[model samples]
Target chain A: METSCHDALLFTAEHPLRLRSGATMAEVSVRYETYGTLNAERTNAVFICHALTGDAHAAGRRPGDKRPGWWDTLIGPGKPIDTDVWFVVCPNLLGGCQGTTGPSSTNPATGEPYGLDFPLLAMSDFVTVHRRLGEHLGIERWAALVGGSLGGMQVLEWILTHPSEVDNAIVIAASSRLTAQNIAFSAVGRQAIMRDPEFRDGAFQAQGTSPDKGLSVARMMAHITYLSEDGFQSKFGREAQSGELGHNFGVDFAVESYLEHQGNSFLSRFDALSYLYLTRVMDYFDPFATPDATAALAADPAKVLVVSFDTDWRFSTEHSRRIVRHLEGARVPTSFREISSPWGHDSFLLTIDDYHRTISAFMERAAA
Target chain B: METSCHDALLFTAEHPLRLRSGATMAEVSVRYETYGTLNAERTNAVFICHALTGDAHAAGRRPGDKRPGWWDTLIGPGKPIDTDVWFVVCPNLLGGCQGTTGPSSTNPATGEPYGLDFPLLAMSDFVTVHRRLGEHLGIERWAALVGGSLGGMQVLEWILTHPSEVDNAIVIAASSRLTAQNIAFSAVGRQAIMRDPEFRDGAFQAQGTSPDKGLSVARMMAHITYLSEDGFQSKFGREAQSGELGHNFGVDFAVESYLEHQGNSFLSRFDALSYLYLTRVMDYFDPFATPDATAALAADPAKVLVVSFDTDWRFSTEHSRRIVRHLEGARVPTSFREISSPWGHDSFLLTIDDYHRTISAFMERAAA
Candidate 1:
């Protein structure tokens, strides 16, 4: 997907997070990229949350030309998120690399990237920032909050915490909470990132070059989870990319290339600190962790549409079912479907139509 | 489980193959471990094949140790494989770590480990070695050839190459051939090994310490594939093993500890040279590549029992289906089932009674 133009105003929290220290009360602002025209009513603002390694540069032209947009197929003129009629805003999360005050952001006090020293934030903190951004835009409520996987987690929390803030919530191929194993996976990733001596307790910003190896490994690990065994086999079964191996580990399968690309490119566009933060947000994100848990949350699934891919092992259909059960319990209008795909968790990014149409219909009802 | 030192009996081979490097051999020799006594007719031999890093220590008590065998409960006197009536033999493969002529084996010409200079082998080569071992043991045929994942791959190739050699083939959590993606994963592991400067082109046998980091990373990578997303989420989602990460990459999650244990312990027992050799065997295995092309070699699918666990992603159940479909087309007697498990590919190794019973029924019929 092409990235947006280089121009965008950024802001950070008045008080920066004091991570590693374990004390709270740290604040950080976010960097955001916006496209499409904001209507006079300001009622058309739609905030989009990105996947694990995604950024505010959803789509545009020429990769940085500032014309098209990320999620271009679904966000421009006549597209699903139709820029022609709606205003779209995406922020680099608190721990993201884009323009937000994340691990990559320079710590005002020391003028260094906050690497590991960034305060550990709850998933709700992300929603809180979205709320602030919404307030800054002078929008009382969101027309829709659309996201997939981790992004979907935000959408879920948004609807739950700020129930009246978003009119429609579209969560795709995402789970309601972190499973123990998912938490374990994230723990390993964080370990990988933290283990890289160069990580230097989150002060790697001045180093310019982050823990590319550890980050790549973390990405590679995450990449593995995003796909189902069936999907992985169907797409990349034991065939060497070149029928023969020089016997080195650069990547000998098309899938390895895909994973490597994901791992490597992510380092360029996303922050490792952000990666740790977001995964943590996801891990600590059990909507059913509180009073009465599932039953209580089930009664509060706000006008939601949950979509899952059969091939997505990360948030398999089972996760979707849990959300559906909650929504069904809440008696909130809900649509749940498990699309068959061999693309794994990535199915959400590629299959624009099925989901686009689902959301389109969903928004129609929400707006009415 | 504790290992027992059997009498160290020497065995014979059935199809002693000539080495591609030009050594003509009449029969192959085998050093093995057995459990349970053979029945009067000697028809209940259940041959167990080990995975890439596995040893011939499948079941029963060690010579003097208290720890049960690796596959103890499943193969003891009255266990599933029924050591009471069936004879079980697990032979260390040709390019294996345990008591086999592998990379660790000294080269006859140079009087050093085969290392990188050793001839590369395919899955067929490993199977051929196993066949030789079978012949040497005075065993005409096995009642059942049982294995999981890589071991399962051997089982599949064994039946394809010598269709009638084994009456029953129980392939668990494995595919007919490594998918391109599978090869890619293994390639990553191999790269981790050989890419290490210390690897010294697998000649690291003389280099004091092998590529421990690379090998550990490789093992970690493989370990992820061994479990299902559900299994991972249930076990280690993002929770810090220490409640808070010193967060760099030193094993923050219990899963990381588990993986590190696997990786580190593997290096202690497994020779890195053989690791490269055997992994290649798995990668080069393409039974269907030429078999589907040539008519004479088109195998009559032997009686096969292919089992898959819902959670085992390494050799996803879909892989099992690919094998079953090929066998079905070839008119080979095959039975396929997807057992429910959250353990992923490891389920094939962990699930006891269910898998054992499946093998029991399948082997009983084959012997009959």
Candidate 2:
């Protein structure tokens, strides 16, 4: 299968977009990718939300691309999401760097990259763009909104803010609210980026430099949280790169080399300002903290499926349990499962038998 | 009830110290603090090893100092270690910054700070300096060697390398070998410090600048691991610093402010080069990986007590269990416990009833 990115001007100066922070964006654009085909009734559309560091490339590959989409394993012709039977639409959420009007985009006023000038965004802002994309595609309601991690946060936001438009919501490895530890980690990552001399207060492009070092450090640290301890041990257990300790500051262990590579490669594709803004979105996410936050679900409630991985310490099973309890309390039809997987938070993207089966079963019922 | 740091020259050109990495240090000075009087026989001496970022001041307030030592809660006159009965001696380890000869120390050969020129060190090197300090204090054998985290690594090394000099060993929240995840965190921290432009390849001191930003970022990340999720949740659960989200790059959550404080406070007391070297010591520590690494214990075993906290995901109870298994395999007398505490790895330094009782009982028996 092949896939190509498509960009659309979702909001223009005449129709400025208002954000959750009470800030307004004069113009907004969305980059998205679609697979399979929309049925005549257009009731088979499934919206896929990407996680942190993820883009709109949910499956297949663009021409000349060496690797398939990040979640290619689960979205092929005969696979779980089964592209043959479902029209999957994945978009780069607001405040993203992947062909979206984000921090790296040009500001009409300054005619330079938005950089730090970009308004701080919230999950609601992302859902706002997603909803626009849905309307732009002429879809009245989504058959299912599927996502994990930050993407999962988007799904929850969609169900809570626009319950009438979401027929089914699948939130995998997400949290209704971030734990203190989660916020602490995100804060440190932001510190790494902002502290970099090259960051230059997020205007590195004008300086002809990038905060690669700081961004790399942030990515490397965050990557560790995405994988399980068991997964790391099994993949790279104190294995010396040269079969002996280097006895120096260089990479001695295989894990060190792996992390260094992860850090370095990330610099080529990600933006520093976008990272800072997106992580803040996750930090401030507390949809349930507001009064009657779930009250919208009481009427045209979306069927919800919350899935968590047993070894995913990042979100953990408790995060899923909390989501289930809240939805159940709101009288929303909800199903929950804690899938056993050693891949950690990254498990959501991998091809696990039970995880795929659970999603497949849920998608089949939702599409019907 | 009072303590003062004392510096002593432990090695000189005429008597250089050889390191496990085949390098040698011509001049080495150790900084230590002693509490209580040593018995006439010197058999009451108990060596205390401070963890990473800890100094020689292990208990009692130095004259005019505001706070007591880091472990003051468990080292008072009637405390667990009981200064009234044991002559507790705590020394700043090699590759440390607390008044010890380390990367910050001037090199006699060049009349400049060693910086990156400081030879890479291992756990064995830390043990060598510690052993020299014991001899300098005229103590033939320590009644017990107690330490936690990196300090705990020192305790394990002392027993394994010089079993005859150690009567008992108390290793708390330590790992016999770091898992890949542990190494990954350390690697990211080193990357953060090294990538700082002010770091100037670890020669920031010579350039009249400091990598305070990078060091602070590293400290903030490490501080999170030192604490348990529950501890963080109860202490700073998504609480806004100003009762409302700033919705900007500044500190928004209470946890962010708390971590920023931790990162900033650490800058005044810690050195980046020392952090790098000390963490490397942990990465290379796998005493039992070598053939018959514990062979020395068969003849002159040090009774061992390995303790782990239930919430210490940094070095979980599994790590302590591994230590116990290794000791028992070597026919060494060993006791193990997983104390319930919300403090995580820092639990080893806190005042927990069962934890203190476990240590007091073990120390009492060791002294007897």
Candidate 3:
């Protein structure tokens, strides 16, 4: 499962790329990592899109690295998205902080980090940048587009936006559009980041201060949604901290400690403003919102495989069902399944046998 | 459905009222509201416990009030728990902010608000205070003890603490103990309040400042949990805030606006320190953890009716099942039903036909 270092790809828009918010931006840079080799016909290229906080690192360990890539379990030499047969390219999304043109990227007009100056991007904007990245790599089409959660949102958008560019798509633990409850959670997460006085109106970079607490709180709030109640109870029950109760406001339960750790550790790698922008993209995502949703979906050319977990309340099976129903209504080739897993929405990222098996079979069929 | 003003009762403890945290305060003031008349046998009094964020107001309107009481739908003359047939008493919980001796109540020794100086309390402490309020009213035994959420927690505690004092008990949307996920949310809420630099380590009262944003965030988080996904989707959906999208972080979705309103309005009524204290009480609740759980349940002479909403993920039906299992295991009279409702944990407060009917039938039988 060895992985290589990430490669930065400059994608300067020849013309201003107008955003959904009616703004335009240019000179976008997208960083990506590739594993395996593109076949001579360039037919075996698989594009992997990342979730909200994910990066281009999808598998393997870097030099002197102790942690494997996030999806290492499914993207290694003989893994589900086997690198031996498929040339896998994982790109950090636009409006992402990790080695990508995002809120932290420099604003060419001002010679400073874009910060709040970064254009409000929709899921379509993210797909547009990734499409440019793909075309730059000399690929005519993607053999498959695979993603989970926010990444899955991109996969749905890609199939709709560039039908001929992708042959097969795997949308796992994702939604076509967020429900009101979904939007509510995102709103709170954004509020947590914005309310921190240290945010300095999203120009904390210039002020040399970080909204660490707010971002931490935001991450903690999101973390709670990522896992199921059973997952939390199993991992950290009412199990008292230090095997004894502390009557004060400190971490009294194991879940509190776990959430605190998740919140603190996330602050080191993620940008707060990027969190705001990316989550907004999720909130605005609604490919099915138009009047002719069926006709719009019917135009998608990819063979779609959709997966959700039974316990994944964050992006429940109902979300997957909605996508499948829409796809079926559009007469698209779609395979949908709700896998049973205790891990909740995070089951897609873990080493679950059924999860891997279902995707592997679907990928094989797509490849054949 | 009319209402009356609240009456304040003071109990100067000859001995300190010991808390689960091993601390004690002597002078305690309990503010309560009573409707209807006590029966000649003094057994027709129904004790109503309030949840977190709820006050002593349960039914009827205050002087010149436009809005009816919170539980006015079910606690009036011809309502489910008819005030005609039963006397009702609702009390502001210990450590509550609503005219009760709580964090905002002045500390006798220091002649200042207790703030964080208020001794950390447990569910047992809350139950103890209400029991005193009952005795002060000269009730030999309550006809029934009913509550929802934290109020439900108190109901369970009272049943266990004084088996003979309560004749019947109805626990709704409550848990015998807090799940790890439950504790996680509470911890984050407390963190939201505590991390606000303005909190001043809970000395905000003395400092003449309030952790308004933090408390607001906390309320918003809890508000999300109180309603089910179906509940939110139906109520708000993807409705835009202004029939158009706003590219900024201010409230955009209808749910966002609703949550923001809920959070902001909650700040005017709830105390940050009490939010911390009460949620801690919930986190520390673990009645089944003790070795005497079987003995404790066996000792309860009350007829217990436990109700849960199918859509209530916050305190799911599983929580109610756990309580019923324990009571049944101890050979206590227990009736349990998981009522179907789209309102989630707040179903108990809403006007659900089956829900009201179930409680009405049970209360009638208990009175009989």
Candidate 4:
């Protein structure tokens, strides 16, 4: 149940990291966490791709930490992920604010935070960094790649671009191509951040101010999408925060207070520029649009499992079905399931019986 | 089909209007538009309530105007509401921006725009002003009260508070109590406006600067909800604005471009203070929560038709169903219809064949 952090200098001047946008990073450092132990053959390693707003910490608590990882419920010894049998490695995404080389990182040339100067990223860039991290970890090939939401996008990208690198891919609540509505929501979030007076064109770091208001607004809005309407009704409903309406704009409903807390707490952990770049990465993600995207998977197809929550409007069951359809059309071994949960896109992070069982059964089959 | 605007001083210092918040408006004005002629009975008058962001104009083009009224398709001579047979009057709601007494209106006490000083309003306050407008029109009783979205809420309020005043009530795409998710969206929108530096504590008019960015962002987010997923997919989808990704953040996808256009265009027409007050009014709307809310309708019920579009996630069919259940429980005559449309909550505003036909048939029955 223990997890340890690992920071590796993955890319340097001699081995610069090239982004999908044609920009190169002279130095790239990856911060990751590992749970359990890799087997002797190094084939027992399962690459975990964290979703938006997620970090390298995938399971168990670090020293002195009060809470375990974000997905701690489903990842541990004898759990669905079964850390006892397989090693789990999660890295902060390439353009992430968390302890990774992202927009907040210092640019080697200017020695200032990249801010808006950072190269625009795509899902491919994230997969590229992930592959380098795998190589750095001496993982010749991953036994499996597992992820949900944005993480799920990485798993699909790996299967599409380098199927031979992984034996199994678990894509949960992810879309091969974002719907127009999805893009619109992400666009609004980006607009919120960019429009903040303190944003200073994403160079707020140099100005000693942050686009906290804008970032908070963006997070609050996105947080609403992460939960199901039924979930919200059950949890908050018309419940007044102080037993009566605030009458003014402070916080009348429990839902508003909850969102305010979510927004405020997010500012302390997330960077505004990183939010912009990472969301942009998801916005432009159109892997299936690429001609012959699955042609590579045809040769050494990875066993794929696409999972979606029934109530997940963010990336609905249709999104997973589309991914399954594409994989099946490519003659790849694929399984799809729509788990019943009231949690929406966030159900992937929770310990729902059916969802965990599906993953557990799939992992067992893949591992065998 | 001709529509002429009418502005009336509905309240004065001699007879001040009392608000739900116990505040008094010494002076209040109502802006409305009338289509067709009132019959000798006066009961032939049909009062139309406009939704959020709507104005007094409901049908026909005014002098020197390029566009007809908002509901021109449904309110013309031979259209759903049939102007030739029924005199239709559409009034701007109480706390509205378009020539109505609202948060943006001047407070006689302060001699400045009310802004945040505007009293917190409820659905009852809107209904109170609406009733005054009805009386001022010299109509003893309305043949029908028709509305959609927030307008629908007003119709419901009329049924609950003044059932004897209207023969029929058609409420479309409204909720008796906003779900937590609904409130969450409104709360984020308010946050977006309030967080803007230009807001200046809602006294932006005094400062000669508007929260244009914040208001635009709010509009962009709400515009997404006003549309169904299928509508966005068909209308904009992931199609690039310029046939290629911009790669940076300035309108890459067609949806983003469309949303930006919507947001930008909204700034010139809508007031931030009004947006705040009106959305708050909706958030606090819980008519059914009041004791024996439908008791007044028990004695002389207004024939009610509650309509909802299947694709409307904002106020889904469940909202309409809830209204019907409440009315039915109180022995009020009510009919319900779940119309299928790709337009989502905005479906009520669109001229869908089934929707129009349903309204037309109901109007005929109500007139009979």
- What TM-score did chain B of candidate 2 earn? 0.98
Question: Where's the lowest-lDDT run of ten residues in candidate 3 chain B?
Answer: B1-10
Q: Write the per-residue lDDT of candidate 3 for residues A1-368, one digit (tens) a residue.
A: 55655555454466655666677787777778888888999999998999999998888887876798889999978789988989999988888888888888889888988888888888888887777777778888899999999999989988876787888999999999898889988888888778888899889997888888888998999999999989988988778768787677888677888888999999899999989999998888898876665564477557999999999988999999999988888899999988999989888899889999998898788778
Candidate lDDT values, in order? 0.70, 0.91, 0.86, 0.91
Residue B56, candidate 4: Cα error in Å is 0.5
Candidate 2 DockQ category?
Answer: high
Instruction: Name the regions of candidate 4 deviating beyond 4 angstroms.
Output: none
- Which of candidates 3 and 4 is the stronger one according to DockQ? 4
The ten-residue window of minimal lDDT in model 4 chain A covers: A243-252
Residue pair clashes in candidate 4? none
Q: Say which docking band candidate 1 falls in.
A: acceptable
Report each candidate's C-alpha RMSD, comma-separated, in the order given: 4.8, 1.3, 2.0, 1.3
Worst 10-residue lDDT window, candidate 2 chain B: B243-252
DockQ of 3: 0.77
Q: Considering summed lDDT, which 10 consecutive residues are worst modelled in model 1 chain B?
A: B2-11
Tens-place lDDT digits, model 4, residues B206-248: 8789999999999999998999999999999878899677777
For residues B139-253, write the lDDT of model 3, one tens digit per residue: 8788899999999988998898788888899999999988888888888888888888889988899899999988888889888999999999999998888988776778878
Question: What residue runs in model 2 are displaced by over 4 Å at the alpha carbon?
Answer: none
Which number leads on DockQ?
2
Give each model's clash number. 55, 0, 3, 0
